[model samples]
Target chain A: MTTTSTAPLGDITGSEAALRGFLAGLPGVDQVGAEARAAMLASRSVKTSAKSYAVDLAISMIDLTTLEGADTAGKVRALAAKALRPDPSDPGCPSVAAVCVYPDLAGTARAALGNSTGHSRVQVASVATAFPSGRASLETKLRDTAEAVAAGADEIDMVIDRGAFLSGHEGRVLDEIVAVKQACRGPGAGRGGEVHLKVILETGELGTYDNVRRASWLAMLAGADFIKTSTGKVQPAATLPVTLVMLEAVRDFRAATGRQVGVKAAGGIRASKDAVRYLVMVNEVTGGDWLDPRWFRFGASGLLNDLLLQRQKLATGHYSGPDHVTLD
Target chain B: MTADRPGDRLTVRKTFKLYIGGAFPRSESGRSFVVRDAEGRFWANAAQASRKDARDAVVAARTAQPGWAARAPYLRGQVLYRVAEVLEGRKAQFAAEVGRGEGLAAPRAEEVVDAAIDRWVWYAGWADKVGQVLGGANPVAGPYFNLSTPEPTGVVAVVAPQESSLLGLVSVVAPVVATGNTVVVIASERVPLPAVTLAEVLATSDVPGGVVNLLTGRVAEIAPWLASHLDVDALDLTGAGGADSDEPTGQLAGELEAAAAENLKRVRRPPVVPEDWTADPGMDRLRWTLEIKTVWHPVGV
Candidate 1:
């Protein structure tokens, strides 16, 4: 079933009243059916060559991340190096799509990764707008996005003001996202590409699948290049059912506006099986359209090693362990 | 469904499944094997765990290792003693399963069941004392205070004894967990009913989930995967050779040991001769499943 609305989304974000009516009118998510469908898709086995392909695809799609308060330049560089060469032993292994880090460390990741951008190049993604907790002023949030963009972040991952959105002041939230998107268009730190803005709803704090759906639409309407699920800091982050609801929103968003936005399921996704399951859901739920790294992404740190290990096991006829892979 | 009921009463058969992550789950492969008694009668159908089940058990054991290891050693002992108490309560059912599965007399089965319960209590006592016995201050030439302590070696994959079943399984498992290591145990393929019952005992006891994941399947089929698994810290091949002479031969044990070398896993090879489970289990298993962590502090004042 498709989740598209008949009304055009060209001017939905022009006013707060129109934005709220559109999100409320778009569609309500079926929690049970969404969860059951996700669980059912999780059980579908993609084995042998299909599994091998999934592993490589998953490896390439990882936003190899490290966002601790104690993150160091050395740690970001090391993570960047791993992203550049995920499997040092096997040169044939694919490099991850990007290296995600805090805004202050974006330059460290960018410097370590060198001047690289676009589809195949390993981009640096930074979480800004007082990430994990978007309880910041609009001026500070804009400055946060601008600094990451100025520091050579190819992509800006901004968190929505969930407090404002939860209290029914979604116009303020939408205005913040649009402002951040504008900030992403500012000076490009010598990198010759548009800084993609990924809007994080932090679905865990949103409280329901209906809210998650509305948030996805709200983000997409406010010019989000990608709609993300979490900030990797909350419980119930990036769950399959929530991602399912978001995927439906993005799919229907494309149908309504003829502009396709990406979906990133970040936080708490660390296993190869779970990553592959997400890929399966993407395949079945949205067809093959969202299978590419440009359209879909996983914001995870430990997930890369597991994908590598699974890749190694497929190559060799034995099960691989964490010892065989680089520690993230 | 049976056609006739003895004494006009129907008996409900128990479903034997693999115990993983503190839950009873059927094998992911959806396969079950008909277990026969010593007299070759249909005993029950036991879940035939596949390689995937073994893999899942390793993941569960890995997840539970840190919390299981972080608990105070004394508290761990109490929890294990609690397991012994629970096992004691289920003694009759275990005795019946062990008797039929091992082809032993009812009295002998009861003895084996009793020995298994005592084994837990024995290891439970060792839990708190093991540190004092194994860890100590080391002599250092430098002006430093050096201390050595034994820590759990992470997830251990144990192949339980095929012939002895109850007592031998307890002998191998209790020691590994007693020292704080979580284990993914491959129960005796021929006789695994007692191991399932033991899993139930562990579930009811204070022993945390994922501490002891039991898989009932071919040891040879599952051992190589566990042996070669990078996440598994140690492997016990006690039942590498077992009840069925056709499976898990001595050569397979050597191959498993070789596979374990990939990650430098601590491997306890199968005994040259059948082991006496009733004999005192030396600190060998405990030591094998533990890593000595030495810390040095500068001597001041």
Candidate 2:
């Protein structure tokens, strides 16, 4: 038996009114099936060479994030340097995909990564759209997104207004996403102004697999480059089932429209094994297309250390600790 | 999937888990390794604690340190004595398990378990007097009363002996916790049953949760993590090079020592002399696990 992808996402809901019908008409998610599929994928054994490869790949996909209230420029610079060189003792550990921070610190992170040794491959990703809690107005969320993009963030992570999405307001969610995606253009829209937009559904608040599916389609149809699982602010931020639901959404979306979107399983994934499990799910659900940093990312802070530690163990036959890797 | 199917009585199996923060939790990594009997048969699947488990243990130990250290020394002694009392009651079980794990005769295993319980009793008595013995007033050429005393050094990581699974495990764990330091112990890999049973004794005793976290897995896999853990104040390398006695285990000990250097963890090496486990351990066991803090007060006219 073959698994069925979501219906071909051809601009059926291109209009505000038409999109609601399209979203409502889309197939509902079977929560048990999604959860069971995620659990089975998580149990997939990845060892030795495969583990080492997954470790490196997971490290590269990490958006080394620090969203604390006590964040300092010094802290952001240190973290950006860590993203550039995760393991100082071993030079071979690859640089992370990006350094995620609040919108205000985007430029500093960009500058720090730019000044890193050799040419820097790390991108500066900023959380915008009123961030963790999307309680603000559309004007406020747009300004936040525009500021992050203008401040040199290569990517913007925007949180949807759960208040609207939960209240059965799919059109409201779509409008916000479209506006944020437009704001991501950063003073130059379409004319080489390409700032990727990662729409954070904050699945923990969305509350169900069906909601997660709706949110994914809502974000995709409106022009999001990536569909992220959480904002790391709320409880139950990221889970296997939620990421699985999102991965399936992205997979089915790409199947429907020829445009490939990314999926990030962020928050609470602190260990190498957990991250590897997410990678396993990504492989089985999204296939090879979403395997790289461009198509998949981890929005985490402390997870990089474990990945580096495991990487060290694979290399030296002994596990490493915080002193050997970045504290973040 | 029973070995003997037709109308055979099934045996009850044991779940080997990690003792962390006073709770029995499986390793967060959910990884387990097959621990075998000395005869090379699958005995049980023991939790293979990952680096994250070591980190969580350090966190648990750190969180438990202040309160456990602040408890009255006499009361601390009582709690430790409680551990011994609990162990005494469960002696036969530990003896049987340790015997099976170490491939030892039942009589010798019983003797080892007895020694382990007695070691706890020894440390229990030392809890109250340790300060008076290790601390004293220092005379200086100043008009000030200066006193130096030994305080529990935060969290400690101990590797229990590979061969002396029970007695050696207790010997290292008892003194460290007796002086008020919380410990994260890695029991003998193939013989973690006894150590886990000890954790149970500790939980039911007055010992607080997070006071002693026990992990059963490869020292090579988890020891370096404990060594470099910033919150871990010291490391007992007593079980560093265990029964395997290979070149890699020695190099692992060296690597653990090197990793401990960054945090400046007071590293304890195995005894220079082959001392008997049954022999009474002097203050030497408790000495390195303490920190000497000196405070001075002005003499009033």
| DockQ leader | 1
**Candidate 1 chain A weakest ten by summed lDDT:** A1-10
The DockQ for candidate 2, computed on C-alphas, is 0.22
**Can you tell me which runs of candidate 2 are displaced by over 4 Å?**
A1-11, A115-120, A188-192, B1-75, B88-119, B141-169, B182-197, B209-280, B291-301
Name the lDDT value of residue B27 in candidate 1: 97
lDDT of 1 by residue, A1-328 (tens): 6546667666788888998888778667777888899999999988999999999999889888898989999999999999999999999999999999999999899899987445578989999998879888889988988999988898999999888999999999989988898888887744675789999999999999989989998898889999999988899889999999988888888887889999999999988899999999999888899999999999999888888888888887777766687765
> What lDDT is reached at residue A136 by model 2?
94
Cα RMSDs, all models: 3.5, 5.8
lDDT of 1 at B173: 94
Model 2: lDDT of residue A257: 79
Model 2 chain B: lowest-lDDT 10 consecutive positions: B241-250
> DockQ values for all predictions?
0.60, 0.22
Candidate 2: lDDT of B212?
92
Please report the candidate that would top lDDT against the real structure.
1
TM-scores, in order shown? Answer: 0.88, 0.78
Give fnat, all candidates. 0.72, 0.11
**Tens-digit per-residue lDDT, B180-229, candidate 2:** 99999999876787888888898898899999999988888898888876
